[model samples]
Target: MFWRLLSTICSLTSCLNAVRVPGYDYFDDSYYYELKNLLEAPESLHGARGDHPREVNGWGPGLELGQVSGVSVDLEGRPVIFHRGPNVWNFKSFNATHHYQGEDGPIAEDPVLILNPDNGKVVRSWGGGRFLLPHGITVDHHGNTWLTDVALHQVFKFPAEAKAPDLTLGEAKVPGSDDTHLCKPTSVAVAKDGDFFVADGYCNSRILRFAPDGKLKEKFGHFGGEWSDSGLYVPHGVALDEARDTLCVADRENRRVVCIRAGLHHHTFGTPVRTLHPASRARVFDVAIHNGVLVGVSGTAEEGNAGGFTADLSSGEMLGEWGPLQGFRNPHAIAISGDGSALYVAEIGPNRIWKFTVGKTFLPTKM
Candidate 1:
C-alpha cells in the first residue's frame, strides 16, 4: 500500500537525504536503498584473475545440471552456455499467468553448451528438447544463437549449423505485455545491423527491440515504477555497446548497471544514459561489454555477496570487484571476449564456466 508505506519510510531513516521528490531521482525514491554508500572496488582491482578455464569437466551427455543460467561468446570465440538440464527454478517455474507451471515439457538434456576456450571441452552441443528454463545466451555478429527461455516465455534464433529456430520471439507458450508476449526473456543483445536487444524479463520489466527479422522494434522499460533509477527490476542482463550506441542493463532489482540511449543510432531516451552502482552488494545478474569494460555479475547470496564487478561504462566508474571475498559463489552470467582477452563466467551452483585473464587490455575504446 503506497509502496508498502514507502518501504517503511525508507527503512526508518535517511531516506536518501530526506526523500526529495519531483521527477524524483530513482533509487532515492525507489523508496530507499543505498547500502553502505556504494562504489568501492579498488585494492588494485580486487580479487580478479582467479582462474579456471572450465571446471565441472564432464561435458554434456547424461545431463544433470540445473542452474548455470547463461553465458555467451561464440563466432569462433566459443563458450556459449544456458544450463538447467535437470531443471530447477522452483515454485513450479513460470507463473503470474505467463504460462508453464509444469509440464510444458523439454529439459531432457542439451540445454545448449559449447565450451573449449582452451580446454573447457564440450566442443559443441545442441539444445536437446529445445529449452524451457534456460535463461540467456547470445552469440551474434554472425554466428547467431540468441536463446532466452525462462520456461519458454520465448525468444530464440539459432542459425550457424542450426538445429531449428530460424528466429522465434515470444508467444510459443504465451507470456504477455503486448507486441507478442515475452515475460521472462532475460537477456539478448545484438546489432551490427541485426538489431536485437531483449531483456523483457521476470514479469514485465521491459526493454525490448527486435527486427533481426523478428519484428517488435521498440519498448523500453517499466514494471517497477517504484524501484526507479529509471525502473526495471529483474532486467537480468542485456549488453550492446556497438561503439557508443549503448544499451547495457542488468538492473536486477536495482543493484544497478543501466546504460541507455539504445542502438540503431540512439534516440536519446529521457534519462539513464549511464547508471552503475557496482562494488557488488549482489544481485546484478549479468552484463558484459568488452574492451572499454563493463562486465558485471552478481547473484542470489546478496547481502552476503557473490562475485563480479568492473565498471567504467563511460565514467560511471567503480572499476573492479571480485565479490564475496573472492570465492565468487553464484555469478550468473557474463561474457567478454572479442579480444578483450577472455573472461567467461557463468555459475549457478556448480554448473560452472569460469575463465578469467583480463588484467588490462582495452585499445578498443569508445569511452
Candidate 2:
C-alpha cells in the first residue's frame, strides 16, 4: 500500500527505490546469489569446466587490444587474434543496419596480432592499414591465415610470413551478390582437399564454395525461411570437418549450429544433417571443431559475458558450458589448441582474450 501511494505521487524511476527491495543490491543480494549458485550447482555440471581469472600481465602495453573479432591457433600452437584496434565497440548492436566503419573508412590500426598463450604477451603483429574491418581469422593446414572483413566485404588468404595476401576474394570495399562479390563475409572453412567454404554473412545469408585455386565452384544456403530447419538467418562462423567431409555453420540469429556434408569429388553441398540448439537461447556467434568436439561461443558484440559451450558433433548433445562466472563477455571468436589441451576465447565487449584449460575428460569420442 505504501509503495502504491508513492507511485501515485511520484515518478516510477524516482519512487521505485523507496520501496524496500532485497537481493537487488551490490553488497548483499549479489553475494547471496553467488553463494547460492556455488552451494546448489550440481557437481557434474560445475565440474565440467574451470578457468583462471583474468590475468593482470599478458597483453603488453604496445598492443592496444580493441574489439577482438576472431582467434585461432597457428601451426606452431600460438594464438592469433584479429581485432579492430583501439576503438573497441564500434557497432552499436548486432542487428544494426550499418556497421560503424568511420566516415572516411576503417581506422588506422593493426588488425592482425599473434599473442603468446603462456603470458598473453604480443609475440608479433601485422596487417596494419589494410583491413577495413577484421572480423574472422582461421589458420589452415598449410600454415596460412584466412581472414574476413565485414566492412570491406572481402576475404583474404595470407601465406605464412607474407605481408601481401597470396589470394584475395571479393573486390576491395565492394559489396555484391555475384560469384565474384561478397556481402559482409564472416568466416572461412578450409577443407583437407583444398576446397574452402565462406559464410557470407551480415547483409547476405549464403555460403560460397571455392576450389583450391580460388575458383568459385558452388553456393548454398538462403536467408530466413525457417528457424527449425536448414535455412540460415545469419551465418557468422564456419568450420570444416576434413575427416568427415562435413561443414559446420553458426547460424547466429537462428540460435543454432547447422552441420552439412560436402561432396568433395562432386563439389556440391549435401543436405543439412543436424541442427544443434543450446538449452538456452543464444546468439550463436563462432564455432571451432576439434577432435569431433564442437566448441561454440554464444553472445553478441554489444552485451558482455554470455558464455561458451561444447557439444558432440556426432550426436549433437551439449557436453558442458562456462561463462559469466568464468569471465567471458561477448565471446566473439574461439579456438582450440593443436593438441586440444587449451581453449582460447576472444571477447569483444571487454576487448580481451581468455585462456581456459580443456578438461581431460572432454574428449569428443568419450563424451
Candidate 3:
C-alpha cells in the first residue's frame, strides 16, 4: 500500500514527496533510497563508463593497442586481451581496404596478452604468429582459453597457462562451408559437459556444434542460399546458458538476439524460444551473461548512435541502454567474470576495453 500510494502520488505530480506522509516509514529504513536513485536504477537496462581501462597502466604511454577484438577474464580475474600486435593503426585501417574474406596470412605480431587485473600491466603474452584476424576469446569452465580468427577461418583452444594452442578447428588458412571446415568463425561458447558451439560467421551463416573430442556433431542455419526457419542471419556471437540448456546467438544483421533450446547429446536445436531486440538496432556485436542477466554491446550504426544494454535473462526484453552520449563506440566483444560481478567490453574504434560492475537493482524485487 505504501509503494502504491507513492506511485500514484508520483504519477499525479511527477515527484515522490508530493504526497502526504502517512507515517515515518521512509525515514525508518536504514537504507535510505532517494526517489531519483530509484528512478535511475533500471529494471532492464545496463550501462558503464569507458574510462576504467585507461585509469590502469599499459593503456597509458606509447604502448600501442591495435583493434582490441576480444577480451576474457582468467582464473585470477585478470583481463586477457587479444590484439593485432603493435601496429595498431594498420589493423584498424585495413578493414577499409582489404576484405578479411579469403585472407591467408596471420597478423605479423603476437596478438595475445594477459594483463594484471589491478594495474592493467602486461603480465604475459604469446600467440604472435598464429591469428590473421583475432576475433573472440572465451575462458571455459576448465580454464582453457579459446579464441577465433576470422582471417584464418579457424578457432583455437589453448590449455590453461600454455603458450600454444592444443586444439584447433577448421583447416588452417582455408575457408569453406563444410562439416570439416569453418568460414570465418566469429565466437564460441562451451557447455558444462565440454561440448561447444561456434558461430560460423563472416563468410557463412551457420551454427556449428563440436563434441568434447573436437569432432563435428551437428551444424544448422542457411548460408544465403535461401532463408530457413532457423532464425539466424549473420550470427556473430554464441553463448550457452548451462543452467537452462539455452543457446543465445547474437544475430548481428538481424539486429536481435535469438535464444534456442539445445540438447547436447541430441545435437539439435530443440525449438526457438525468444528473440531479444535492442532499441537502437545497431549491430549487436557480442553478449555475456552475469547474475542471470543478459549484457550486450551494440556498436554505433551509420547514424552514429551506440550503447551497451542489459535485458531480461529469460525474455530478452530491453532493460536499459547507454548511448553515444555515454561514450560507447565500436564495441565488439564482451565477457563477464565467473562470479557474475564484473563485465568487460572490448571496443575496436578506440582500441580499448571498459569494465562494469553487475548489481541486482535491475531485477524485480520479491514481494
Candidate 4:
C-alpha cells in the first residue's frame, strides 16, 4: 500500500510539472505536435523521418561552425553564409574537455562560406589567413567580395577570382590595436560612385568612410547609449538606401535602427524613421533593406541561444518567428532575397544555415 501511494504521488508531481505556463511555451505546434515530441525524446528522433527535421532539406547539408554571423545572396542567385567558431584550428578544440589546452595553440581560424538552398555546395571558400574572427560579408556591384574580421581589425576587398584580397584597408596597415581606423569592423556597404562605408562595430563604436582609392574620407559616431546624434552603441550592421540616398545603421545595443539621410550635412545621423523594439526584449543584430522593407535577425542574450523573431519594416509589427527549429542555437545574422520570397538565417552556435520559405505574409511556413 505504501508503494502504491508513493507511485501515485510521483505521477501527480509529473503532471503538475507539465502544466502549461503562459508565455513559456517557447515551441508551439499546430499539427502533430512534432516539435514537442522531439523535445521529449531527441535521441529517438535523431535520424527519423518527418516533414522537416531541423538541419537539412532534400539532401542538402548544413554549415559546420560555432555560430553563423552573416549571410548574403550572390549575383548568381546563390545564398552564401559566413560562420564564427570558437577554436580556429582543430574541431576538437570546440569540445570543452580540450578547450583549455589549446588556448593559444594554432587556433583554428577560418570563416566558411556555403551556397545553400542549392545542394549545400561550397562554390568558393577563403579567409583563413585574412580574418581572426570573420563577422560580416557584402558584395559590391563590381562582383567583388568585401568581408570584415573583428579580430584582425581589418576590412578586405577580394576580387572575384583572387584567392587573396586585392585591397586591404584599416588595421592591416597597423597591427594589434583598435583605433578609429578600423577597430573590429563588422559590416560594409558600397556606394554607387565606388565609395564604401564600414561599420567599425563591436569594440570601437564608429562608422568609418573610405573613398574609392582606399583613403579615409571621414569618420562619424561615438560610443553611447543616448538616442541623439552623438554616439552609437555596438553598431553591428549597415546598409545603403540607394534610392532614398540614406544610410541605415543597426544600432544593436540600443535596440533601434537609425537612419542617416543622405545629402544631409556631414556627421548628422537623423532620427530613426522605424524602430523595432519588441516587448520580448530581444536585441537586433544584422539588418538588410530590400524591396522597400527592412528585414533583420534578432538574437537572445545568452550563448547557444536559439529562437529569434522578425518584424515589419514600416510598422515594426511582429511578423513571425520559428526555432528552438532543430535546436537553433544562436542565430546571428540574416539576409532576404530580392523578391522577399525567402529568408535565410545563420545559426552561429550549431554552425548551420537555415533557409525558410517565407509565406505569402513574410513568415516561415511548415514544409
Candidate 5:
C-alpha cells in the first residue's frame, strides 16, 4: 500500500511540474541558429561600402573604434547596446553622415541599438536629436529609458513609447552653463524611490544625484587617487545595491571599484571596503552587480584586445576571468541575464554583442 501511495504522489507531482513550466517549442532553435550564422558572416550583416558591418564596424569606427558604453536587456528579453563614436567629423572619412544633420556641424555618433548576442539585427534605434554623444543608458523601474550624453553634458529621460526623447531634465536649465551642465556623464542608476544617480565621468569625475522630479539633490566625488575616497579619476559605470543600500561606482582610471553608503553627505564619502584589480594593466570599463558578485569588463586603450572578469562584491576577492570568446574585441559593457546564468557583452570595436551561457547542472561534464 505504501509503495502504491508513493507512486501516485510521484505521478501527481510530475503532472504539476509539467503544468507549471512552459515548453520550449515557442523558442524555435532553427531561428536562433540561423541568426547566429548571419552574425558570424560579416557580409550579411554589414551594409554596402558605406554599409554598417553587422557583426563588427557596422556603425563605423572603421571596425577599429573602441567605445561601448552601456548594455542592457529590454522588457521583451532583447539585448540593447550603446556606444559613442569619437566625433562626427571623424565619420566623414568613412562617408558616414549623421542620421540627424545640422549646419552648426554634426553631433558625435549617437547611440546605436543592436539585438542580443549572435543576432546582428538592427532593432529600432533613435537618439540623434536627443544626444550629442550618448555615453550610457539604463531602463528605470517605470519602464522609462534614461541616457547620459557626455558631450552634451546632460542626462535625458525618455518615455518607453517615445520615438524621439523628450527631455525630462537637463536641457537648457542644467545648473552649469548650457554646455557645462554635465561633466561627461557616463553611467546611470535608478533607485527604488525613482531617484537616479549619474556617474559624471571623463571630465568632471563626480557622481551627480537627482530626484525623480529632475532636481539635483547632491553630487559626490572629484578627481583624485585616494583610497575609499570621494575623488575619482574617470568614473565610468554606476550600480545601486538595493539590498545593501550602497552605491557602487566603477572608478575606471583608478583601476578599482568603489562603494559608498547611499544618502551619505557628498563630502563625507566613505572608505571603499572592496577593491577589484586585475593582474594586467587593463582598465576596468564597466561593472554590474549580480547575486552579490560584481562582474566587469576590462581592456586596454588600444583596439583588438578586451576581456571580462568577476569578483566578490562583499570581499573583493577575484573570482575568475574569461575572454577571447566569440571574437570579443574590446568588450566595454556587460549585462547578466535575470537568472544569472547568462552574460551579454558589448564589443565596441567590433560593433557586436556576444552571449555566454553557463552550463546547466543536468548537462554531462566533458571528459
Candidate 6:
C-alpha cells in the first residue's frame, strides 16, 4: 500500500533511482531505438547439423568436480571451473520459497577448481563453504572471477588472488525483483571497463546492467511469448565479445542464442541483434565468444538432440556443429580459449569434462 501510494504520487523517474549512461547526444534519446537487421525467431527452426568435434579423452583425471555449472579461462590460459562439488540439484533441492531444503547445508568439497590446460591437472582449488548450488562463472580479462548461485539468488566477485569475495550482489537466501534483489540469476558477463550484465532468468526474466560499484544502471527484458523480441526464458549463459561490442545470450528454453549491443549504444536495448538457432530440439545451455566465433552448447536429453553449433557471431551464419565422438549425455557449460584454439565443455549427468581442439590435431580415441 505504501509503495502504491508513492508510485502514484511520484513520476516514473522519481519513483526509482536512475543512473545516466554517458554517450553521444544521438544515443541519449530513449524514445528512438535503432534496430538494424534484427528479427524475432521463427516458431520452429531447422538447420543442418555440422561436423563433429573430436573430443580429447582423459582430460581432467581424478577431479571429482560434480555438476560443473560454468567454465572459463584465466590470464595464464588455465581452465577454471565452478561446480557443485558433491551437491546435486534435484527436484526437491528448493522449496516453494526458492530456499535450499537440504539438510546437508553446503557441500564439503571445494567448489572452485583451477586446472593446467595442457594435461588437465588440478593446480589450485578453493572456494569451499562460500556458495550454494553454483550455477555460472566468468573469468574476466583482469583475472577477476565472477560466479552465480541459484540457491542463494546472488552473484559474487572473487578478485584475482583474493580468498573471499570482495564484491557480492543480491541478498543471501532472499529473492526479489527490486534493484537490491535477484531471483535465480543464472549468468554474468563483465566488460573490459568493469561494467557487467546479469541474467535474472527464473523469477524476474530480466537482464540487468550494473556499474563497477554495483549500482543498477539499466535493464530490459520480459517473460512469456516464445517469439517476443525482448522475452527471456531460462537464460543460462552470457558472453561479452570485447572487440565487436556484442553480447550474446544463451536463451536456453527458447532454443536460440541471441546477440545485442553491449557498448554505449543499443538499437533496442532488449531486442536481439542476431538470433542463431541450433537443431530445433536442442535446448541451448551455454555460449562462448572469441575471435569471430560464437559457440553455443545444448543438452536436452528428452529431445534427443543434445549437441552444439558454431556460428558467425556477427552474421548469425551457421558454421559448424560439435559433439563428442562418444556422444554427449547432458552437456551443460562451455568455455573458449583466449586464442580461440581450444573449447571446453562440461556435462552434468555423467559428470565429465571435455577438451576439444578447435581445428584438427588431437589424441585419437584410444580403444
Number of the top-ranking candidate, with lDDT as the measure: 6
The true-versus-predicted C-alpha distance at residue 199 of model 2, in Å, is 0.7
Candidate 3 lDDT (Cα, 0 to 1): 0.70
Candidate 2 whole-model C-alpha lDDT, 0 to 1: 0.75
lDDT of 1: 0.71
Relative to the true structure, candidate 4 reaches a TM of 0.69
How well is each residue in 1-367 modelled by candidate 5, as lDDT tens digits? 3345445655676566678843334446554444454444433222111222112222222232326567776666666666655443233321121122223333444465746443446566656544555568777666677877654556778778676665555443133422236655778888768778888776678887777877777778778984647768888888776665667887887877778766643424344555568544477788876656666777753643356666656666665555531445666677765555556667665555666554322111221
lDDT of 6 at 282: 75
TM for every model, in the order presented, reads 0.30, 0.79, 0.76, 0.69, 0.67, 0.81
- Which candidate, 4 or 6, has the higher TM-score? 6
Best candidate (score: TM-score): 6
Q: Please report how far candidate 6 places residue 88 from its true position, in Å.
A: 1.3
Give lDDT tens digits, candidate 3, residues 1-367.
3466556654655243445643344453423234433444443343422111111212323336788989888888878888875433345523432345433456666688777665567788888766777888888888899999776678999998787888899887677887888877889998878889999987678888888789987776765421344756788888887666678888887777777776754434646767787887777888876545677787664447577777776655567775322467688888877766566778887787766655545422221
Q: What is the Cα-based lDDT of residue 20 in candidate 6? A: 48
Model 4 C-alpha lDDT versus the unseen true structure: 0.60
lDDT of 6 by residue, 217-306 (tens): 888677754587677787778888767777788888888787877754544455457887875447889988776577778866666777
Q: How much is 81 displaced in model 2, in angstroms?
A: 0.4
Clash count per candidate:
1, 2, 5, 12, 8, 0
What does the lDDT come to for candidate 6? 0.75
Off by over 4 Å in 2: 1-63, 87-101, 104-107, 265-268, 300-305, 324-326, 364-367
Candidate 6 stretches greater than 4 Å from native: 1-52, 265-268, 360-367
Winner by TM-score between candidate 4 and candidate 3: 3
lDDT of 6 at 167: 87
